[model samples]
Target: MEKLQVLDITGLSFTSLPLSIELLENLKSLCLDQCRLEDVTIIGKLKGLQFLSFLDSTIARLPKEIGGLTELRFLDLTGCTELKVIEPGMLGNLVNLEELYMENSFDQWEAEDKVPRSNASLAELKNMKNLSTLSIAIPHSVNLLRDLPFGKLNMHKIQIGEVWDCLCMHKESRTLELKLDSSYLLLEEWVQKCLQRAQDLHLGGLQDGNDSIHDLCIEDAEAEDGDEIDDDPKVKSCKLRRLTLRNLPMITSFYKRADYPVDLFDAQQLVFLVTSIIMNSVGYSPFAVNEATSLEAITIERCQLIRKVFDLEGLTTNEEVEILSRLRELTLSDLSSLEYIWNKNPQRASCFQNLRTLKVQNCENLRFLFSSSMAKALKQIKEIEIVSCDKMEEIINVQEEELEEAKSADTLNFPILTFLSLEELPNLRTFSYEKYDIHYPSLTRLTISSCPKMMTFSSSERKQQLMRADIGLQQAFGHINSGLSLPVFFNEKVLFPRLEELKLSSMCRLKRIWHNQLPEESFCKLTSFTVELCENLSHVFPSNSMDRLQSLNKIEVVGCPSLEALFEWVCLSSEKRQTPLVLSALKKIKLWNLPRLRDVLKSDRKVNFKSPCLMEVDVRCCHSLPYLFSSATARSLRKLAILEVSVAITYGA
Candidate 1:
């Protein structure tokens, strides 16, 4: 029988089947995901079989005859919980194999006899001369295969990086991968010597057995009591740049004298740094953090110990400052213990000269984030992202009232900030700066999400910041849509000059987008606006202020069910003067998932869009929408797509 080209038997619940799979001589692809099976014995007879997958299936063992399928190229067996072993000599004949995936539980095995039995099990795979890619879960560590005969074959194009029972491969090889849960603790001296040849190195995975971080730290403390150790040799032979360590629990401190000392010398040319769960607790002063002059990006996660290391001031010198100053991208996540960063006195803080991107997430314990002095340190930063930080009482904590009273005193603040993103925060109510001026001339994009408790910016509720324009209360508050009205007791509002994109999503309690405060001049450069999931917003951008929004290009409203109208009022005097002038710049309009929007254009609807400039209009999933740009406006509409929407356009003859 010819092999099957494609066999998709997904979601099949079969416990046993005939071992006749080898009869499919021309099979090119086979998928039995989620099937319940025990063994794959019939697969060996399929001489032309190429691809096979049993992901999420229950299979325990493979027949030794599996090696007979020389034409097989890809094989996957991820999530096969019953798979206990790979039969010995089942893979040596698969010379044409290119990719192999095995998601097995090899880390839980403990018996010493179980180790060799597993080794003897894989004796056939070493003969696959043409194998290019291999992804598998080792029973313990990669060191177990160090003595295997794989030395004869040179791997190319692909490399295996995982957290297994293997010591760091100090070897200089290509195509590298290093996982975070490996067998680094069981590594002997000989294994380390052999790994010194790998070129691309991956440093990841926590140590197993006595490798528990708490235990390792205690052991190191006891051993270091002996004497003053000097001349800690370096591993300079390994030229590694790409490093990834995930879930490294013992990283409370980076170095130790008896175990592993500070290793900045290895991989000095690193360009990327990523780590997860780095809890640095080893309390040693002047910690050995190498200077990565070539470092461009660094990501830190849940590293509680970082607070002490970066606690700068007169304590560190220029060389240390220069190291962090060169970084461009920095992402900090889940560092819950971080209070105040940088020096208490702003003048001594390290400056990030090339740093453009800064992302901070889930730092719940972070209090006053930026001091006026520290804000001056990040002058080069353009993009800033803060999310899920519940304890952020204030950004620049100094009282604004006190600062204005002393404005004559020269104070430096963040003036270069351009892009800002705030999301998933509950307690962040204000971002007021009093002692220092916070201005962003280059500001363009602002994205705010899931901030329920946030009311507004500034303290005095009465004084507005630079807002100078006339806009309708209903329109500005259209972002708040239906039920509740945004209270605008203050006369002035905030101003954004160069902003092009503004996104507000899921503000459930928001009754209005802005207070009915007036501005000096309209936001001239405002172009694109997006409002989503704000159910209460009823009307926005009154027709009178339509001319002031001359640069408005596009507006999108999605999932705002409570909004029944787009615009409520229009000034007749202003309309007659314009002489039916088109909203010449408006390009696109999209309205989706708004169940309350029953009409697009009504006789009383004074809304006018520049249809000549409008290229596309998409109205989808709005079941009640009727009419096409009030018979007065549809003349210039070029393209229209209506999905799951009902439209009624009545032409009055």
Candidate 2:
């Protein structure tokens, strides 16, 4: 190999060349960035080096013989902010050139006339058909592109959007973008539409009102009727898939009916659309109709509007409005006045039946979401989440007799529900089962947090006594016990056979999970469990029976101050081998904030068969846990963590 090429080297401390670096001749890229070299003018001797990246002011201006390398492809002069005025025809001989990247730091201070004219000859660029990409930071502001001397050039991608607007003039360019600030106005009629293949379109910082300077808004375009005029110079759909309208505080509305306007319903190929109308307090904007049949996802944010969204009048009945049949996801948020969204739910066959997931947040005035008849029609929904809505107290409410009859009928509905969450609602008191009752045996995740009074079974003893008197004593206890039983009864077998995750938080009076009966396979597939802040809960599980919980892989007990004696009771249990309390599948255990008496993993005498599968233990803020794993028999345990506890234990070998 010939000596490796070095295009340009400067600002380094080296006084002489390293003799070993002279063998690799084909090197085409080089940069000596911000080093401390002095008097390095031997660069012309490297004949094979092509690309050169040199600082402008730190290194002197290039020698007139700098065009010796005929194979130059790229040159970067970014850090030399003060360098200006290139000599005419400085790069005319570079016939194999492809790109030139320059960062013009002098643009802020230089006048438009004082900046150097293009020293490189025009014949070089026009003759090179292989040239694809060009990036330049112009030293002085000018209308750079309107009168460009080059003919039409074709390329697949061009990104020129972020350059300051005063640097480029308005022109019907290729696939390029023009970015303007909130106060900068480009004449709407002079707007140049570009690129027959342009697929993505974005407009930023365009403001509204007459005196504000931004007169070229979509709303300002001349309109005839509500329909957009087809003769206007608008991009009639190419291959566009994604369109985003964000942070435009301009005159309201997306499409001007008279000029540059077309219907999305007319575009039959549209798929995904995201729009934010935060400042638009407009009276109406009909975004989609039956023409947009291929739309799959739509998100509407901060559009504080009048109550109703879609009206079922002369167009189509609620049953006929199949506007988004292929739509799989929809999100609605921050519409404070949108209380009753679905008014035509009573007349429709089913709305949002194909919806798989729905998230509603911060909609305070949303009192009713789809009449009860509509929610019952959704069979394909798998997840529903509601959070931080102060006014949406009760989503589903039905009579108690209806719930009993539905349970007696043994329905196999709720075929797809696997996750449900209700959180941060302070006004919610009762969650009636009948209106929301669907058999979700496939549910693997359920979280209920921060709702204070979600009492499915009444906690009042006087009310229980009165109900018992009305029903007579014998049937009341039976009903109360059956009503409070958990693990869900399905034809006398447990329903949650696949459930692996359960969390309960902030429930102060929920003293028990099940009052009397137990499932034949309680927690049969339960792998992770967490229960917190149940201050009235005196026991973790039902008093004497834990026969069905053989599949527990991990358990976390936290924030219950009254249940501190639980571990001591477990340690003092009957040591008979036949009736031993064995958690064989349990591998991880954590206990936190239980401040009372506790002794865990203790053995007064040497044990034969230990708690075989307990491998890890974490104890935090438990003041009473004096010793853990004190037994000489350590079987499967490999790690233990303890925090804020005044206890120490010696595990014997």
Candidate 3:
């Protein structure tokens, strides 16, 4: 017991410490996390106590007598919301404290001008010369010391004015979450010093004298001109890792300073950022966004006035900078006024080569996400989820004849794409309408739901984009049809070789998922297939690639009133060379509500359906289904264990 170096008493309630508790004179660390206590100056008896923690505790006060523990090197009072007082001279006495955490704790700090001190104050921190880490929240800054040299702390998380949820990390470097009154937004020396070194900053509740909240000087972390920030945005070498702007209801623009060449957030060091848009500035932007290499993620949500995220239009710059080269994630949600993700001009010098995940939701006004030129650079993208954007007609907007001319042989490939979800897009027509051969070689999971108007995968032939403008003009002058019509989705090519699951629902106008006959290697590995509410779809697979469904393990078709047959080429093939229709690995099939489904497989002769592994079949509400399969095909389902037929079945279909 005498050699005890650590003692932790967690989740207990007590009024005072027992006399025997003080016997551990060699205890260097004492943790009373989440405890309740009123009075116990007995902690002072442990002269060897170097580390003390009252994390999330209900200790109302810190007895001044315990300040005699000058050997204390660390003290934590984080989340001690009930703690209101630290007796005067208590903290000043602990000169050896290397790390002190008092976040969300006592804030009734006695001002330096008080006649008689009743509780501890900021002046107490002056003697903590060895303190290198400080995490504190000060809701009341009126009595703060104007000369507090917080720059001396090697690592600090300081919240000065208003308080928010403390989710931002400290990164073992400086972090500041400031939301002070209008007067305090000025670059006070100490505040400026904090800004200069802050790796993560969360600024909210800022208002100028006229309540305009237009303070671009904060972006210039290196500026020395007190309040004279010039119109030309300064290009400061910033090291900010994350920035969050909240509740600023006036600044409307994002990344553009309208008529000026302002490079405000061109820090080239921002890792993650949150922006705010508000009230009424018909059009605004984060003017002149210079390319940054350190930004990893960006989330812009609920910005009512934002129309565009990245607008590089009319930029005539000669220098090239890769756009957010390290950014891995980008999310935009609930921006009602959002019309474009990227404007007419894709930054010719930029690329999204490293962005892996993109999620967009509830932005009703957005028409398209990426142009063909913007999409060509997304080689590392893996996951994309876009939902409820009413005006979204396509994922990629095909450029006019001129821009599409030279992009014929280009392959817009998502090499590592694994998952894609597009839901509730009422007006969505297709993924793309033109010029390039889109590839999803590694796609595994795909879900498309409620896209009622979507009928084609891609309509444009790459050769069309290659046609010369002179030829196009001549063709137009002659009024001759080059024989171009809206083609069906999923053309004749090898795509999605690694696809595992495909689910489609509520596509009322979808007559075909694919029309052209694809190669045998395409969709060869698809395991599970599901389609529902697609009333116009007649068949599932193309005839040429039907034999490649050896890997399909499950199928569920429901509510497809026009589905006459489940598989293509259901009639028996006469040639001996023809490959027999085989679902060798199929395990389950569910057919329901298909009023017009005539048969699953119809074989007139020996080329019958052979599903040696088919186990379960469920058929219901198919009043018009003539038969499930031919007698030869039915006999091949030897492993079928469970068969469910509804009362509406004719002769137990």
Span of 10 residues, lowest total lDDT, candidate 2: 270-279
lDDT of each: 0.51, 0.45, 0.70
User: What clash count goes with each model?
Assistant: 52, 17, 13
Candidate 3 yields a Cα-based lDDT of 0.70
| lDDT, candidate 1, 1-653, per-residue tens | 45357778887775555556556656778788888876566767767778878888877776777778788888877667677666554666677877766544222232334544542234445566565445444434443443433322233112234444232232323323345355553243322322322233344455442222211112221112132212223212221232333444445443323343422212211112111111122311222223223334555565543342234334333333333445676776776665654433323335556677888888887765665555556778888898888877556555353345445434443456678888877655456533233345567787877765444544333223211211233345445443444432111334555667778777554444543443535345668878888666565444344555567788788887776666544445655645664556777777888877765422253545445677667777665555546555776555433323333222341
lDDT of 2 by residue, 58-135 (tens): 543444344655677765555555444343344555556666544432222222244464344333344444454343
lDDT of 3 by residue, 310-391 (tens): 6555543345545556667778787787777764433445555788999999999998998776777788899999999999
Best by lDDT: 3
1 or 3, greater by lDDT = 3
Best by TM-score: 3
Every candidate's CA RMSD: 11.6, 11.4, 7.9
lDDT of 3 at 478: 28
Candidates' TM-scores?
0.53, 0.51, 0.78
Once fitted onto the true fold, the runs of candidate 2 whose alpha carbons sit more than 4 angstroms away are 1-387, 394-433, 439-448, 453-497, 513-523, 542-548, 562-578, 596-611, 620-653
